[model samples]
Target: MRSAPRTEHVVQEAYVMSRDYIRYVTGRAAKAAPTVTAAALRHAGDDLLAKYPIFFKRWPRVFKAISSDNACDYLFNILDQHFQPDKPWQKKELTWSGILSIYVLAGQLAIHCQSHGMECVLEELEVRVGEYMEAKVCPGIREKGGWSGFVERYAEKEEPERAAVRACCGVLLLLASISLTYYMYRRLR
Candidate 1:
């Protein structure tokens, strides 16, 4: 017997931000706002990779398989592991860096998939990242004065897009660094 349909309460407050985020990162931003372009998000990912090389190294298997059909599940698991909420019912309290890292991590997954000659997961990544941000991140981000505050904090001296030019620097390095991981994986066979 099927139970009654359950209705979900949807919040539209962060819809604009989420849409802008998906569009910008997926390269659909027609006008391309200066605040948080794809390049800026890439730059943020690059920074996160550089800052925590060891962290990426620990997830060789996960990174390698991140492009599979279950990609979003893996991404969500990583997000929850790294960015847990204070309580189950409470929303996450993220620093600006933390929020940026989520996108960066997704970017790394995309990079890994690309480097391995896999099909692009940008569409799935966009949806998963948007869902994560809207539900877990937007409230905290809003408290910090929204995306404008992000520009103030990280893009004070230059446009956030500039960072994108150097995007995936760390992921590139880690993939090479994973030459060792791959070697080890092969050795296990």
Candidate 2:
């Protein structure tokens, strides 16, 4: 006889569906806003935010959708409504969503700074991210011995993503490097 569906499994599916529905609703709201002219966004800016998967996976598409319009407001909406710090990743087990969302926010700030011709935005963003990680991520992630211990623990995992709960930043950095190098090579030619 086939085993009946487990209650836990059913609950998890519902939870995930709810999160997706929330995302869809907010995405609709973002779409309703006025868009900026192409001329305005052609100036471009750094994409430091794309380093983080969660936001990178979503924000750039939203940025494109509105033609770089209402970026700060959109970002705030993303942070306050979409991310919702209280949501707790995947129903309360350990995860990186909160801290990483803050990192992505810093990257967004950096992009805003670059577009506005503000100086030292990268440095400022780095400081903010570092402070945030220390304040938020370290408390949960650090082990008995501290940060190094946490690193050693995660390093032993056969699937780092399973332990870390996000795709490896090292791999993303390497890919970004390759893409940037190719772009620069083409530009010089």
Candidate 3:
């Protein structure tokens, strides 16, 4: 026998719960307007939930989505938003490893958001990465221009389109790392 449909209240409650989790990871309150564009991400997650009631039951699907072509586009768009040459870069002296660390953290957070039935927008990801860089990488390189220096180097040497392409490559690398981690875990099991 088929099960009865869930009440609207139930669905709303689920969405609220998911939203709260997202806010916690994103470090933003529900009432606060997201500084970055995340509406699309949220909608995507909600849509997936509606189409597949137990979408979160399988972790792999969430992982796959974050690493998908769609995600690459999302990441690239956000980078383009922040790295416009018209606006000077703010932090520059961050080390390559520090940048990579921030990206890795972003990938982890993306996975977490997806697992909890939430979408992580590109702006949201960029904000989180920025915060991470400030907290972890800025201290060492604050004198060196922090993130601005890195951006200036790229902006001076590379065209905006090329920079965006490179950022996409970085996103792909993160996704590949996620895939590798999951494969290793499964193999161990």
TM-score of each: 0.56, 0.31, 0.26
**Candidate 2 lowest-lDDT run of ten:** 37-46
RMSD of 1: 20.4
By TM-score, the better pick of 2 and 3 is 2
Compose the digit string of candidate 2's lDDT tens values, residues 1-189. 212222333222222222222222223223321222111111111122334446455554555532233444454555546434555665323343353344445454545445555434344334434433343344454332233332233222346557554556667888999999999999999
Q: Give candidate 3's whole-model lDDT.
A: 0.46
Better of 1 and 2 by lDDT: 1
lDDT of each: 0.60, 0.39, 0.46
Name the TM-score of candidate 1.
Answer: 0.56
Clashing pairs in 1: 39-164
| Cα shift from native, residue 54, model 2 (Å) | 11
Worst 10 residues of 1 by lDDT: 1-10
Pick the winner on lDDT between candidates 1 and 3. 1
Question: lDDT per residue, candidate 1, 1-189, as tens digits?
Answer: 111111211223233334444454445555654334334554555566678888877655667655567777888898888887677997656787787777666655655654565545656666666667676776566566556656556552555677765566767888887898899899999
Predicted structure with the largest lDDT when compared to the true one:
1
* Residue-level lDDT tens digits of model 3 in 103-137: 43344456555555556463455454444334434
